[model samples]
Target: MSRTKSERYFFLDDADREAVQAKGRAHNRLGLVVHLTSLRYPGRFIPDPRQVPTEIVAYLAE
Candidate 1:
């Protein structure tokens, strides 16, 4: 079976949280996804192809 990516969230500072909420309330909406990337790998054999960057795929594997 295949594994999927998982995410962890960190809360913003009180002021930033308030500002985000205020903007959402005023606009009657929320903004786009502003987030970070976290990756996990499998046991010995298989590599996570998603985590590999385009520029140096072979070098990374070697």
Candidate 2:
């Protein structure tokens, strides 16, 4: 099972969490994809499908 943003980044500071929540409200799918991919590739840009992992693509399809 995949962990939620809060579960995955339990140590996030208040400002970071608020920023993430703001992004969540603006880009739901993108947020999930970014969060999942960031676990493996931190500080990397994920602007589109070509940048994301195959596994993340499959998960997004569902």
Pick by TM-score: which candidate is best? Answer: 2
Task: Give lDDT tens digits, candidate 1, residues 19-53.
Answer: 55655443231220121111222223224444434
TM-score of 2: 0.29
lDDT per model vs. reference: 0.29, 0.50
- The pairs that clash in candidate 2 are none
**Clashing residue pairs, candidate 1?**
none
Candidate 2: tens digits of C-alpha lDDT, residues 3-36: 4532443234466555566654545745654565
All candidates: TM-score:
0.26, 0.29
How well does model 2 score by local distance difference test?
0.50
